[model samples]
Target: MYSIHRSFADNCMAVTAPVRSKGRFTIGCDIIEADKLSNRLVALLPKTLDLRAANAVRLGLRELLINAVEHGCLEVGFELKSKIAESDDYLQFLLERQKLPEYRLRTVQVEYEIRPQRIVFRITDGGKGFDHKHRTHKAREDDALAHLAHGRGIKMSLRIFDRVRYNTAGNSVTVLKKLA
Candidate 1:
């Protein structure tokens, strides 16, 4: 038997009881301020996954969560991020944005569920959502677009997750990967 604990702001905590051999299970959920995410958060996942899958989850979740923090919460759009990437001012911009009251107060909510066949995650960010349909549908893998940097995260998410679906407003995303 094992349990997973998730800590949120204000010292709040959520704990998942020992998982059973049931068909599906709702593990736990957590809320973290957009600016507060870190690599250490990866430890929040259960040890149920093997090394390779765990690494994939860490990388995929980090990218998507950072997208939520940077794009969804901080309102850094594609064009601006592209320019920042070229100028190598992204770190500075992130620092400045972290101080903004509006962006500072926003949060990202994450929910996790374990099922007999897969693991599901629902991640939502505080921001005016975008056109998820257009973004996901029109994303092309041609050489021209592949050479760009901004869309790589989304492209990577598409390939990594068994399924990746975004809300109509695009502020929320649900991803799942098979567990075996």
Candidate 2:
């Protein structure tokens, strides 16, 4: 049996469930501030996690969260290009985004479920969604750019997760990583 309890912290609502068995654990659903979600996640990571795996998870989560914040929530796609450009070019690009005031009201929902076998993370945002089918197909078909800096987060996520799926609207991603 699962019991649900609702609470609030840091200006966000949370639903939490406590597991009754040794192998099972806690499940948490939270609506978080987009700007601080990554820091909260980084603080929550278990100390015993494998260094490489933990790093990959951290990087992937950070990038996705940033994408959701800067692009999805703020409707600022040009900010992403700044991340990929040369230092001088990036600085100029960032300056442009900084002048816009559309970044004020963005938020994201981050859900976490911890079980004995794996950890599941779901991140959802409010924004104009994308075409999941097209993105998935493109990732699978592109091989010549294996080591390219672009889209590395999605690639790393596919490799690390036991299962990964996106919501129909493409605004949410669910990832499962088996415990080592």
Candidate 3:
């Protein structure tokens, strides 16, 4: 397995990659501060992944990072009304959360296992967990206004992965997709 770690100079954050590999890969652990995730994403794009999978990887990673930072780390109930008031409200909400002492306690972890046919990406967050059953059912029904704002991530993730699974607490998600 390959490992990489980066400590952001701008903020109270560090990005650590404990494991990364292409063939027969396994991502053991990665800890990234919530505030620096986007910057890390920008830095990680060209180095860690191939060009062919970059777009899908970026999209998937963006959503996962947002979910981890917003809902998981901040414990903000996903609210569609706030989004309607301001397109960037979700981002602002995250920024506010970062100013809080609680944000310092949050970290996002991504683990993976690669096989000949597929790759599995698992993302875990440090936060109060949500009920997976209720969230999944709400997602399936697609009847809530919050679904309009929050549902897109799940839809996008499903398109990018062959299969997706969430832990009972909804703080972790596993995505699997076959290699081309």
Each model's number of backbone clashes?
0, 0, 0
Instruction: Return the lDDT, model 3, position 18.
Output: 28
Task: Mark the regions of model 2 whose C-alpha exceeds 4 Å error after superposition.
Answer: 1-36, 77-101, 142-149
- TM of each candidate vs. truth: 0.74, 0.64, 0.63
- Tens-digit lDDT track of model 1 for 1-180: 122222321111122323322221111111133223423333444445554565566667767887887788888898888989998888788878867887777777777776556777787888898887766765545443587866766776787789999988899999988877
Per-candidate Cα lDDT values, in order, are: 0.65, 0.55, 0.56
**Could you give the C-alpha RMSD of every candidate to the true structure, in order shown?**
7.6, 10.0, 8.5
lDDT of 1 at 122: 80
- Report the error of model 1 at residue 2, Å: 29
Cα lDDT of model 2 by residue, 33-117, tens digit: 3334554553455444544565566656666666565455655454365454635464454345534555444456678776656
Q: Is candidate 1 or candidate 2 better by TM-score?
A: 1
Error of 2 at 74 (Å): 2.9
Candidate 3, residue 69: CA error in Å?
1.0
TM-score ranking, best first = 1, 2, 3
Q: How would the candidate models be sorted by lDDT, starting from the highest?
A: 1, 3, 2
The top-ranked prediction according to TM-score is 1
